[model samples]
Target: MGRGPPVIDFSPFYGQDKAARSKLEDEIRNACLDYGFFQLRNHGIPENIQKEILRQSEDFFNLPDGVKDKYNKDVGEFNRGYERLRSQNFEKLTKGDLKEGYFLAQDLPLDDPYVQARKWAQGPNKYPSEVKDPHLWKKTVDEYHFVVSKVAKNVLSVLFDTLGGGHEFLDDFCDHPIAVLRLLHYPPQEPDASELERGIGAHTDFGAVTILLQDSTGGLQVRDRRTGDWVDVEPISDAVVVNTGNLMMCWTNDRYVSNLHRVVNKTGTERYSVPFFFDGNPDFLVKCLPSCIEKGEVAKHAPLTVSEWMKGRYADTFGGSQEKTAKEMVEV
Candidate 1:
C-alpha cells in the first residue's frame, strides 16, 4: 500500500564528500539492487531552470500541428524532432500511447565525423521555428541537457563506487556520449478508460540510465520484480527520477533489475515529463561484469558491442528498414 519511491538527496555525495557520502553510497547501491528506480534531489539543478524548461516544452507542444509537423520524426529520421501521437507501437497499438514527444539528440555540427557517416539519429536537433519563445525553448532545453548529463555521470560514479570499481570501466564510453532528451505530453483521458488505455505501454529503457523530470500530474508506474503488481511512481518536487536500463542490466551481469514500467495517464488534466537517456559509446563492448560473475561461472550473454546490440534491438522492435534523411525526398 505504499504510495511513492524513495527520495534520495545527491548533496551528500556531491564533490569533496565526507562521512555522509559513504552512507549515501550504500543506500543508492541497495536501492539500485532492489528497486532500480529512485528520485534524486539536491542534484544542483535549480528549480527555476526545471520549471522554465517545462514551460518551454508546454509552449512547443501546444503549437499548431502544422507547425510541429515541420519537425516530425519522418524529417529527423526518428532520432530527433517531433513524434506524432501513437506513432510508436510500444504495445503494437493496443490502446497505444496517447502522447506526443519532441526528441533531441546530441547536437552535432553538419561537418562532424558522425554526421558525415550518416549514422542513425545522430545529429543536430530539428526545432520548429514557429514556436513561441523559440530562443528560450532552445536555451532551456540545451542547458537542461548539459546539466542533466553531468548529473547522470555523477550517478554512474556512485554506481561504480557501489560496485567497488574505478571510473575506468565506464568513463570512456561517456565522453561525448550518445544522449537523448525526450519531452513528452500526455493529453487528458476519459476516467472510464481500461487498463490497456495506456499513455505508454509496459517497457524497460534501452540505454545505460534514464533521468526523468516529471511534472505534478503523475501517472508513471513500475512493475514489481517480485510481485505481479504495479507500484505508482509518485512525483516528488525538486527530484529527478532515475532508473537503470537493459544496458545496465547487461553490464551489471544481471546484478540489478531493469524493471518494466508503464505510464497510465488517467488523470483528466494534461501531464508532461522529460526523460534524459544517457547511452554508451556505440563501439563499447558489453559483457559480464567481473564482479557479478563468480570465479568459474560463464557469463549469461555473449560479448556484444553497444552499437551492434542496439542495432539488433532496433531491428527486432522496429523493422530493419534503411533510414534516410528527413529531407531525402525533398532534395533535388
Candidate 2:
C-alpha cells in the first residue's frame, strides 16, 4: 500500500462486539499515533439527523447577509453567532477563509449570573428571519446537537479508558457541558487560484474534541505526524471525522495530540462541514493526567481553571497565534 495518510476501515466499530471493538480501539490509537487523523465510517450517529442538520445549515447560509447578521454573537467572551465572511481569524495569515459560519451553543439559564456576566462569550442563538418555517432551524439543529453530544459522550468514554483511566473518568467533567456546532459554507474558488492560500488555513481545534460531518465536496487535509506532510482527508458518506483538541491534550497530560488540519477548495464545487466542539465547564480545573507523566520529566504546569486557560487561548486564537501554552500539572 502507498505510504500516504493511513486510511483504515472504521465501519467495524459501530456497535460491534468486544473482540471487534478492541480492534477498532487499536485502530484509533494507531491513527492518533501515525496520522493524527482518520476517516471514520458507521460511527453510530443516525443518517437522518446528519442530513437534517446539513439541510438546515444550507437553508440558513443561503439567506442574505443582513438577515444572517441578526444572530451575530454579542456574548461577552464568545464569538458564537453569525461570523461574517472573512470575519474569522483562521484566514488572517492569508486573505480570509472562503466560508461563512453560523455558530450555535448551549443556551445558559436566564438566572445564571455567569450567563449574564459573559455576555460576550455566551448568549442565546439568533435565527434568520428568512427561514420560512420558524421551527425548521432550531428543531433540526437542536436535535442534531442532542444526537452528536450523545456520540461524543460514548466516544470520550472509550478514549479515557484507552488512556488508562476508568470508563467513568470523563463522565463527570462533561455532565452539563458547553459545546458549539459550527455550520460552515465554503464557496467554490475561481479557476487557476491557489486554493490552499485562499481556502481555510491550517489550524488545530480549540475545544476538548471535535466531530466533523462533511459533504461530498472534500477540501479537508490532515497532517501526517510521522511524515510532517499534509494529506487529504476525504469524506465517507455516513462517516464522521473525530480529532483531539487542545483541552484534551492538557487533560491527558499530553499523551495524545491535537491534529492540525485545513480545508482547500479542490472539488470544483462548494463545500460545507459541521463540527461539534465539546468541552468541560469553562470553570473546571484542567490538570495533567497521571498516566502520561513518568519518573524523569517533572510536571511543570500549575493549576488553572479551564475558563481562565481558555480565555487566554481564545484571545490568542482571535489574534491568530498557532502556539498554545501547555501547562504541566502538579502530581496529585
Candidate 3:
C-alpha cells in the first residue's frame, strides 16, 4: 500500500482567525502543488445528506436493466441522464470502463434560455420514475446538489486566494456554472479479468476541480508525481476527496498539478462514489492567472472558454461530432 493523500480539516478556513486561515491556506497550496489531491473534512455539507444521496444512488442502480434503460443518456448528450456499464473508455489503451454512472447538472426548466438555446450541458436532468420513493429520491439529489455546489464554490475561492487572486475573482465564472454531479457504481471485477480491464481507466478530469465522496470499500488510486507509482487514496469517514483537474492546471500555467487517477474494484462487494465536478461557467474564458506566471515565463495554453474545452472533451470521450454552430458561438 502506498501513502494516502493528506487529510485537511476545512472548518478553520471558515473561521474569523486570520492566522489560522493563513496556515490552512498554505496547507491547501502545498497539496495542490505537490499531490493535486487531498481529503477534505468538516466541509459544511451535512453527513445525513451525504448518506441519503448514496442510499438513493444505490437504490437507483439496483433497479433491473430494463427499468434503468428508460433513462439512458443519448449518444451526443454530455451530462443529462443514466449511462450503462462499459459505456466509456477513459484510457484508450485499456478496454471500456467497467463502471456505470448517472449524470446531473444544475437543473433548469424547459423555458430557461440556456436550455432553449441547447447550450453545452445546459438542460434539465432526467430522473428515474421507478425508484422506491420517487419524491424522496428527487429531494435528496436536489438537496445534495445544492449544498455541495456551495462547498465547491467556497473551495474555489480559497484556491484563488492562494494563487494571489481576489476572493471574488471567480464570481462571474461560477454564475450558472456547468457543474456536474456524477453517481458512479463499480461492481467487483471478474475473477479472471485481464490486467487491461479496469473499473475506470487512468485519466485526469477535464474540469477545474472535483469533490468526491467515496464509501468504505476503497479502490481509488492516484499516480505519484515523483516516483511514477500508483498510490492508494484510502477512504476516510466523512471526508470528501478533492482534486485539481486539467482546467486548473491550464489556468495556473502548470503551477498546480492535475495528477492521473483510476479505480479498480478488486474487492468482492459493489462500490459507489459521488463526484461533484465544478467546471465553471460556460462562457468564462480560462486563461493563465497573472499571479501564476513567473516574471519572464510565457503561458503554456491559449485561452478557451469552459464550454469549448468541455464540449471537445465530451466529443472525444463519447465519439460524437461537435456542432458547427456551437463551435462558432464560442469563437465569437
List lDDT for all candidates, in order.
0.78, 0.70, 0.86
* Residue 91 displacement in candidate 3 (angstroms): 1.3
For candidate 2, write residues 1-332 as lDDT tens digits.
12444455555556557887787778777666555566666667789888888888888888888788887764434566787776555645656667788888766565666577763335565656678675877888777878888778766776775677565546666755667888999888878766455457777777677889999898888876667777777678867888877676676656677777788786678788899888766666767777767878654456566666555555654565545454422110
Candidate 3 contains a number of clashing pairs equal to: 0
Clashes of each: 0, 12, 0
Rank candidates, TM-score, best first: 3, 1, 2
What's the residue-level lDDT of 240 in candidate 1?
Answer: 90
Tell me each candidate's RMSD, in Å, in order: 5.8, 4.0, 3.5
**Better-scoring candidate (lDDT), 2 or 3:** 3
Per-candidate TM-score against the hidden true structure: 0.91, 0.86, 0.94
The alpha-carbon root-mean-square deviation between model 2 and the true structure, to one decimal in Å, is: 4.0
- Quote model 2's TM-score: 0.86
Model 2 lDDT, full chain set: 0.70
**Candidate 2 wrong stretches, greater than 4 Å:** 1-16, 75-78, 112-122, 192-196, 300-302, 319-332
State which candidate has the highest TM-score.
Answer: 3
